[model samples]
Target chain A: MAHVISMLPVRNEAARWLRATLEQLSILTDRIVVFDDASADDTADFCKSYPKVRYYRGDIPWFEQNEAELRRHLWELATYENPEWILALDADELFEERATLELPWLLNQEDYDAVAFRIFDFWKGTEQVRIDGAWNPWNRFSPLLVRYDSTLSPDWMAQPIHCGRFPLSYRDRVTFYSHLRVQHFGWARGDEHLKKYLFYRERDLAVYGAVQSHTESVLSSSITLEPWIPMPSPGWFSEKEHR
Target chain B: MKKRIAILTSNHFEPSGARQVYGGAERYGVELTKLLLDMDCDVEWWQVGDNWNKEIIPGVPIRGVPETETPYQTMPHLNQVFFEQAVDADGAIYFVMYLAYPTVFPNSISISHGIYWDHPGMDKFLPSALDRQEWHRRLQLAIGGVRSVVSVDTATINWVRATWPILAQKFSYVPNFVDLNSFYPQNKESRSPHPRLRVVFPRRATTVRGINEAGKTALWLTESHTDLEFHFVGRAHDDNMERTLTTWASSHDRIFYYWLPPHLMAELYRFSDIVWIPTKSSEGTSLSCLEAMASGCAVITTAVGGLCDLIQDGYSGLLIEPTARALADATKRLASDPQLRERLGTHAREVAETFSLDRWHSRWSEVITRVF
Candidate 1:
């Protein structure tokens, strides 16, 4: 069996839904690697309580200044385990229940090296996902699970923000977009939305001269939300294994 | 001694840096450079860039000139700059015809890819009647100034002949070519049967290439037929356009979007069963269409620009107007009828043989012998 490892980055996520996130990840991943970005709270203690998780803390905060560096550090720590596949996720994101059943067959396939899934951003409540403007992550595919190749050197983007979790070099490899969904609960509450908006205004204003439209759209009153619906299982999942 | 030649164009690499551009024009430049090298000529390419120099291909140095913009068109200024810079070369080749406008050098040739002003939206660029007339006057001067004008299709030659009868003598109709060995039908015995019929649109994601129309048609066809798959295999001009196409493809299970370089395109064409070339305007003998035809894929193209010269309605391939409805109807017809696809694909391969790279090299050599 191939080992599936999950690498997560955290910052003051103990007060948030970190426990629920870890519980969900425990069902799908063989081991969970958590990197705390010098959180002020006891997020390190909370994460270390889980038996599957291996915790590490940064000496100094680096998420706001440079995201690519933080992700590279986490990647180096995750690769030390010699995992077959690495799933990069955040502290607030969780794969739906169906992923536990569908991912085994996907990982066993030899054709594709990376798997991209549709991400849903839950807004205001946990039952609904945002669909208006750029909040609609279901419109695009995001590659979360990648087969770790030791021979190729991974190159990270130099940007301070919006730098992807996986190396940009994985784009040239064959990627399969699976019909799986990852639910994000970062914006599920009202207070956290305000804090996120303020954080962007502080960090992103220096990088981008003007406020990004997607950032502004998050606070718009005329937002649209759709109920969360799990995708049906693929036909191959039910077929009998010949071997 | 080898003949020294200078080639001038607007862009060989992306303006941002030294990245090689991927499109029909860039492919033509590569093929032309190879032909020139085979004829024992020393060639160099010059384009608008940030004064950086690099090699486009081995032994072919691509020099960049700092770009300048004017209130009017910037190409004429770039042309003068290139002419002044390459004054000592034996001859020059204007990769784009309009770049030679209002300027001329001795022993020079110009190439017209196709008519670019055929689209309805061109009125916004040249708004008045006098503006349109002045545009024609500039084109006339450009054609008269060059020693020879090599056009990729007869549509451009016919348009020039109707506009200025005297300049018709200078025009040479040399349509684009494809390598038959690289792009050919996959053998029937080796072919693996799949459930879904793969249809491909192998052009850039641009308005003039009719990506919007093809995208709309793809949505309709995928919704109507469950056993059909649509693949878009080309790059977009910008990140936003690429994102839009990616989003659309992601929303549908049977649709896919990706890009490949020129060498890998042959394999993709062979994998595809049907090819769509729904060009709205501003097209030459599109290299994608030629490659797809050579790969023995049943092509459905609009009768726009040089596409009219390549595909015959109901014979070589299905020809129709540039519209989403027309594209959808043709795709639906080709999807249900496999025999029609095989017959059209067979005829398309036969037609493609007439436009092989060997013939193109010979024709270009004849023209080069006369001018250089």
Candidate 2:
């Protein structure tokens, strides 16, 4: 059987959805690299309890203070497993069940060096219910899975706010878009969402030299989360459900 | 007294040249400048470009930011200029939120071109979240000083009001115009009399303009019909799209590509039996529909934003949803009927003439005078 590893660089993700998510991930990948960035919460102790998970903590604060550094360190630690492929996901992100099966086959294929998937960013409290201009006016294609090359990785920067840039060279030609989707639940908690936006506003001013929006301005226009069940597009997700 | 106003843009607005999809707001600046000049108003131009017309409205001044090798230098210069001119001009008009100017001018107005990176659904289309935030923040700076927020279409007006409640009552509608004299009809008989139908796409070769959709239609038609010819007039937005299109065009003999200046476009329309404008919702009224109609070609478009206001299916032009396969079906329908194409082209020209530069000036002249 091909070896697959899951790499997660986390800061303050505690008792939310981490436990249940890990249980699901363990079914597909044997080893899980959980890089803890000196969290004030009991995230490190909780993650250490999992059998298939390898939790590591940095000495100084890095996740909130310096995201790029945390990601670089996570990438470095994921390399030690020498796995066939790495599924790098954020603490708040989860794979659609179909992606769990489709990923193994996609990582086995030689046509692509990296794999991207449609990201169903749940607005407020709902899932992929509203796609076409119904919820947040945004839907995205993001790189969630990468073929493991022991020698190569994304170059890290000190103050990169948005996930550090991926290489454009191989991304243009060799990237394959998978039928699976990623369910993002970051905007579910109000405190978490507000903190992230405020941190981003300050960081943007430091890096870009201009930012005029207040946190309340975004909140005023934000979509109210609906209690709708996830209605993912009919693809591999539906095919698996029929079985 | 004539109202003195200034407009800011990122793309250099050439006074005269080959016309491309500069859209409603960009062209509105020049037209308003002309109309203001006719009303004896002083209109100046400020933007970052190589060619800055020193005398935009005879005595009115103009300035372009000297090409900064890096964006770092450009923003500082813009901030300096904005600070200096914030209280000076009678009014100002910013094309979009991404233009990075003051949000509010007591007498000034801002125009909404379409969705920007910061807009809720634009994560995939734009560069990054940081870029979107920067644009969002910059847009907030001038919200207080501007008198009204203007958009080219009603849908966008509704969208802006709903999205930015701060600018709720400020949003207004101003449809884009097509110069009838410049893009006047060619003798329909002068076109190739062969049974083959010639289709023209007057758009910048970008995904936003539905190039992939156009490609789908072109590829299918090339395989299915020997009686259809496709002509792509505008250049690609990026090198990747350019290379992809160049390779694609090379494979098909039925496809003809032209990336000439806008000055050559008036005559260029004479060769088309139909012009396809299947673009995304990011546009106000498609200038392509009006221009194609004025050039005496039937327009087949999608009801994205402003195009809905312009096209009356079976009358002025054909309308469909924004999809590649749908566009292919529409093209096939137009190809099969020449008289319908002729009738639509004629009525489309009439529609284009109604929304001429003259009508735009007369309609906005009072509003411009009242605002300033």
Candidate 3:
């Protein structure tokens, strides 16, 4: 059997999409390690209650922590589980079927060191993925599903404040499995929607200061589906993949 | 009872490395005239530069007028000559290629291929700079007298209409379509194996085509994808372009080819996995891009001219700014993903089917009828 484990680093994700996101990953992998960054809510206690999830506490608060260092440490800590491959995840992300992506068969393949999945940034609800403006990663983003080879960890961190440090050395070895879609629910719900936007803006202001040039716009209610083109189906919900 | 039509061009249209050929406008003029003749419409083709007069087609005679002897002036007397020639023609239309007009007949349509002001610094080209001031006056002259204005893309028509609101009511959108039969996709299962993922650019060796930007993109893409190959297929316009590209090709092992005949051009498009057109301006429905789509190559182009009409960014194709960095980044995105390429190619082919030669003939016939 191919040994597969998942890694997640999150904070204050109590009422966010954490529970549903974990439930989805549970069916795909045997183990999960979530590093809780000092959540004020019962997030730490709630994650530990899951059958496959193992909760660990981060030293710093979520906002105070440097995302790159946190991501690198979490990635390194997960390798201690000694799994053949790791399914790296954010609390807000949900993996979807790639028509015929057999994870077991994929893990057994000797060719690739990492796999990059397409990310659909869901806004307002599960049905719509944000494709407007520069704030989003547009239509595609590659979060790593890396093999636990000692030399294979990414040297480069996710820039301008996202998660995961990507390695320049793994460029050729990385296979773009776009069918393995990830539905990002970071911007869709309650006050968490506006909070996430302000969180990034706050981070930007703290670093770049007053000259940040509008910090990119949030997905407004006015934004709707691209009526002319068919969008890739969000992985969170079992919506029919639009052709 | 076919309507008589006269088409005008400022340059001759032959393939690169032939007797003489220029840029996109020259090629487009040739293709349009040929297609019109194939429809059995009465056609008269006139060109400036050479005085040689001959009939390339049975009924259609190509009249070439010599450029008047003057420094930095090409066909200064064309305005008078074209007016006199059109007396015999039922209707005359001058193809407005560079926002520069050699001639504009009264009550005739002015079909713009490019807008000068839209692409800033384009007036600095040595040939165009000589008569740059003349273009503004001649354009204003054409706007008043011309029956209507036609543009190949909605963006260009909108720009023209916005710039000169006086011509707003007289503007129409008539895009040039592709030869779907000649350039088409074969079944993926039956194709021959390619050793490398081919990236082809069907752009001429000219500054406007963005060859230099394409060179930078190829260099940047090579670091990630060692098997990536870039093939440029078009005649070099000058010795300078040839020398520059030749030097770039020498530095890289993957850079290949100079140009291909139309038959071989079809094969190249079919063979390519990705197509890149670096042109920022002077594209009135880029035929090469349309042909690539028909041949099933996923295209990425600078978001300029008629490209915005064909591509929907990440959908059918990618539209980015005409910069080396932008081209390199977009190329890397498309080069890494096979599924994205396949999806985009499938959608692109569907788009090409909509603007097939039959549809082009329909649109062309209407323009001729309405203009006359």
The prediction achieving the highest TM-score against the true structure is 1
Which of candidates 2 and 3 reaches a greater TM-score? 3
Q: Write the per-residue lDDT of candidate 2 for residues A133-230, one digit (tens) a residue.
A: 33331233467666676555356654665554232222332344443556777666656667767776787787677654543344555444423333
By the TM-score metric, which is better: model 1 or model 3?
1
Flag regions of model 2 displaced more than 4 Å: A1-243, B1-4, B13-26, B48-62, B66-80, B85-88, B97-103, B115-121, B124-144, B161-168, B190-195, B239-251
Supply DockQ values for each candidate. Answer: 0.05, 0.01, 0.01
Candidate models: Cα lDDT each: 0.82, 0.64, 0.66
Model 1, docking class:
incorrect
Q: Kindly give the stretch of ten consecutive residues in candidate 1 chain B with the minimal lDDT sum.
A: B66-75
Cα misplacement distance, residue B67 of candidate 3 (Å): 2.3
**Which regions in candidate 1 have their CA more than 4 angstroms from the true location?**
A1-243, B18-20, B68-74
Best by lDDT: 1
Error of 3 at A228 (Å): 53
- What is candidate 1's DockQ? 0.05
Lowest lDDT sum, 10 consecutive residues, model 3 chain A, at: A234-243
Q: After superposition, how far is residue B320 of candidate 2 from its true place, in Å?
A: 2.1
